[model samples]
Target: MRRPSTSILFIYGLAITLLAFIYRDPYSLLLISIPNAVAGIYLGYRRAKLIVVLLLLSIWGTFLNAYFLANHGQVVAVLGPLVIREGAVRATAQIGLRLLAIAGAALIFIGGAEPEQIIRDLEAELRLPKTITFSLAYALRLIPLLRRDYSEIMFCRRQRGYRRIAYLPGDIKTLLLPLLSIAYQRAIWAGITVELRGFRKRRPRYRRPRIGLVEALLLSWLALQVVLPIMAGWTM
Candidate 1:
C-alpha cells in the first residue's frame, strides 16, 4: 500500500536514526532497523536500492577497519600482514549495525518522498517560520539551476585547458567569483519574485490530516523498537 503520512514518517525516521546510538548491542540495532528496511522495500523499491548500496558500503568499510586497524583481544586468524581478532569481529558488527540502522531510517524520509512536497507539507502543517520555509522551497528549485550553471562553467573551463581539479567540485576554487556573481543575480530575481507574490507575516492555516489505523499501528511499532531494546538492557 501507500505511505499514510510523510510527517509521521519523517518523525519516525529521525527518531530511529537519532535513538539508534543509545543501544550497545548489535542485535538490538539490527532489530530496530528491520521494520524500517521492510517498510522501505514495500513502499519504494527504487529508492530502497540506494539505501541497500549504502549499507553494503558501510558493511565493507566496517570489515576493512576490523581487518586492518582493529588490533585488540584474542587472535582469531592470521594471514601474513592481516591479523583477525575476536574483538575485531565484534566491533565490525557493532559499527556496521549502527550504520545499517541509520541508513534504514533514511528510507522512511527520502525513499518515496519529494523534496518540494516535504518542504510544503512542513510549511503548511508544522507552520515552520517563513524564512526557513522560503529558503528550503527556493533551495530545491535552485539546485537544477546551479547544476546547469556548473555545466556551463565547466565547459568554459575545459576550453581554457583548466585542469586544476579534473571535473571535481574543487575545480570551482578559481571559478568561485563568477559563480558568486551568477548566484547574486539569481538571489535578486528570487527576492523580486517573492515581493511580487506579497509574501508576508500572515501564514495560511492548514487542516491536520486524520491518522488512520495503519498509521496508528506504525506508531506502535516505532515505540516497540526502542522500548523492547531498552527493557532488555541493550543500551549503551
Candidate 2:
C-alpha cells in the first residue's frame, strides 16, 4: 500500500493518543492499543520491537509505583512497606496500557517522513515560519547522524586500545567533546550548503497530501473506536 502523507500520518497518531486519554478502562485502553501496535508494525517491525521494549519499561515503572506507594481499595498483598491492593492493580493496568497507546501512536508520526518533508509540511500545511522549520529540520537530521558518528567513534576507540566498554556506551564521557565538535562543524556546513542550494529562493508552492480510500478506512476505524468508549461508558 502507498504510504499516507506525513500530515495524515500525524493526524492518525494524534487521534490515537487523544483516544487513549478518553478510554480509561483496561479493556478500552487495550482496544485502543491495537491501532498503535498495528501502525507501528506496519511502519517497521524492527523499530516496532524497539518501541515495545521501551514502552514495556514505562509500563513496568507504572506498575511498581501503583502497586506499592499508591496502593488503594481492598488490600491484595502486604510486603511490609510495599503494599498491593485490588484498586492499585486495576488502576496500574489501565495506566500502563494507556501509556502504550499514547507512546506508540507518536512513533507513527516520528517515523512517517523525511526531515525535509516534515519541514515542508510544517511550513506549508501548518503555516510555521521558515526559521522554526529549518531549526527543526537540523535537529531531526542531527539525531540519526549522531548515532552513526557514535559508532564510528567507538570503532576508532577500539583500534586505539580502548576497552569493549567503549563500544557499549560506558565511555560516553569521552565521546561528548568529540561529538560536540563534530556537530558544530556539521551545523556550519549544513547551513552553508542549504543556502547555496537556494535556501533564500522561493520554491514552487507545496502540494498537500492526497486523502483517499486509505484515509477513509483509517478514519472510519477511529470513529468506531471513539463511539465504543462512549457507548460502554468509559471515561478518563
Candidate 3:
C-alpha cells in the first residue's frame, strides 16, 4: 500500500485531537479514540510492534473509560419499552468505536511516512516554510534523543554517587535543564554541519509525486473535515 502524504496525516491527527476535546458525550469520546488507535497501529513508521501495543492500550483505555461512565448511569438509552443495559455493556461498545477510528487514522498517517519524507511533504505539498520544516525535523529527532539523554544523565548521576534515585517524573525535573542544554548544543553542531555541507544555500527543489487515488482520498478526508460539521451542525 502507498503511504499517505504529511498534510493528510497532520489533518487526521489534528482532527481527532480536536474531536477528543470538543464533545462531552461518551459517543464522541469513542469517535475520537477509535481513530487514534487505528492510526497508532497502521500509520506508525517506527517501532511497529511498540506502536501496535500502544494502540491496543489506547483502545483498552477507551473501553475502560466508557465502562466507568456506564457504571455511573450517565450513559443510557431507551429503546421502545425496554431500556438498553445501563452501564459498561453499552459504554464499552460506544467508546470502542471511537478508539478504533482514532488508531486507524494514526496508522494511516504515521505508519508509512518517514520523518524526512513527512518534513519534505509538509514543506513542498503543504507549502510550509523551509524553516518550519527544518525545525520540525529537528524537533522530531529530539524526542528520542531526549529520552536517551535522560537515561545517560541518570546513569552519570548514579555513577557519581548521588544517593537519591528518582522515578521518571523526578528524573525529568532533575534532568530537563541539562538534557535541553545538550540537545541545543547538538542542534547547533548539526546546523553548522548542514551549513558546512552547503545545505542551507542550496537551490529550492520540488517533486511531482503523482496525485493518485491516495491523494484524492486524502483530499476528500481533509475536505470532509471542513464540510461535515457544517452539514451536521456539529462543532467538531
Candidate 4:
C-alpha cells in the first residue's frame, strides 16, 4: 500500500497522541493503540524496534515513580481490592498505555517519513515559514550523523582500552562531555556551511501534494478512532 503523505501522517499522529491524553482509561488507550501498533509492525519493523525499547523503559520508569509517590516511601502494598496502592497501579498502567499509543502512532507515521519530505510538505501544504522549516530540516538531517559520530567515539574509546563500567554515573561522566563537544562542533560547522551557502536567500519551490483515496481512507479511519470514542462516551 502507498503510504500517506508526510503532512497527513504528521496530523494523524498528533491526533492519536491527543486522544491518548484525553482518554484516561487504560483499556481504552490500549484498544485505540492496537491499530497503530499493527500498522507500525506492518509498515516499519526496524523503526518500531527502537520505539518499543523506549516504550518499555518509559513504562517501567513511570510505574516506579508513580508507585513511590503513592506509597510515600513505604513498602509495596499487598495485592488486594480497595487498596490505596491499587490507585497507583491503575495510574501507572494508564500512563504506560498512553505512552504506548503515542509511540505506536509515531512509529506508524514518522518511521518511514523523510525529514526532507516532511519539510517540503510543511512548507508547501501548511504554508509554514521557510526559516522554521529549514531549521527543523537541518536538525533532523543531523540525527543520523550524530548517531554515526557516537559509534565512532565508542569505538575510539574501546581502542584506547576504556571499558565501560557498570555504574551509570561513571558511564555518563566518561561519555557525556566528549559527545557534547562533538555535537557543538558539528552545530557550528553546519551553521557556517549554511551561512556561506546563502541559505537565507535561497527560495525552495515546493510542489503541492496530491491527496488520493488511500490518504482519504486513512484519515477517515483515524478520525473514527478518535471521534467515535468521545461521541459514544467511551472517553472523556
Estimate the lDDT of model 3.
0.60
* Clashing residue pairs in candidate 4 (N, C-alpha, C atoms within 3 angstroms): none
lDDT of each: 0.69, 0.70, 0.60, 0.70
> Against the true structure, what is every candidate's RMSD?
6.7, 6.0, 8.8, 4.9
How many clashing residue pairs, candidate 4?
0
lDDT of 1 by residue, 1-236 (tens): 66556566666777888767877777687897666667666655553453564366567667877767775899888999777888788888777777767777766566555666766666676666767757755754665566567668767887898973433334535455566789889999888888788786447567574467766877798888878877878754
In the range 1-236, model 2's lDDT, one tens digit per residue, is 66566666666777888888877677688888866766765664443344554466567667766766667888888888866888778878788878877766766655665556877876776565677767866775676677677678768878877764532233544655677799899999998999998888845355666678776776787787788877978764
Task: List, residue by residue over 200-235, the lDDT tens digit for candidate 4.
Answer: 786666667668987798789887886776776774
Off by over 4 Å in 1: 66-68, 112-116, 128-209
Span of ten consecutive residues with least summed lDDT in model 4 = 164-173
| 1 or 2, greater by TM-score | 2
Candidate 4 residue runs with Cα over 4 Å from true position: 72-84, 135-188, 202-209
Worst 10 residues of 1 by lDDT: 164-173
TM-score of each: 0.63, 0.64, 0.55, 0.72
Model 3: per-residue Cα lDDT over 1-236, one tens digit each: 57766666666666765564464455455445554564466445353443454345555565556545555554365658634455755566555555555555555555655677766777666676777777766766665676577669878878876544443344435655687789889999988887898866755457545466786876676566546555766544
Question: Which should have the higher TM-score, number 1 or number 3?
Answer: 1
Model 2 misses residue 79 by how many Å? 7.5
Residue 134, candidate 1: C-alpha displacement in angstroms: 7.7
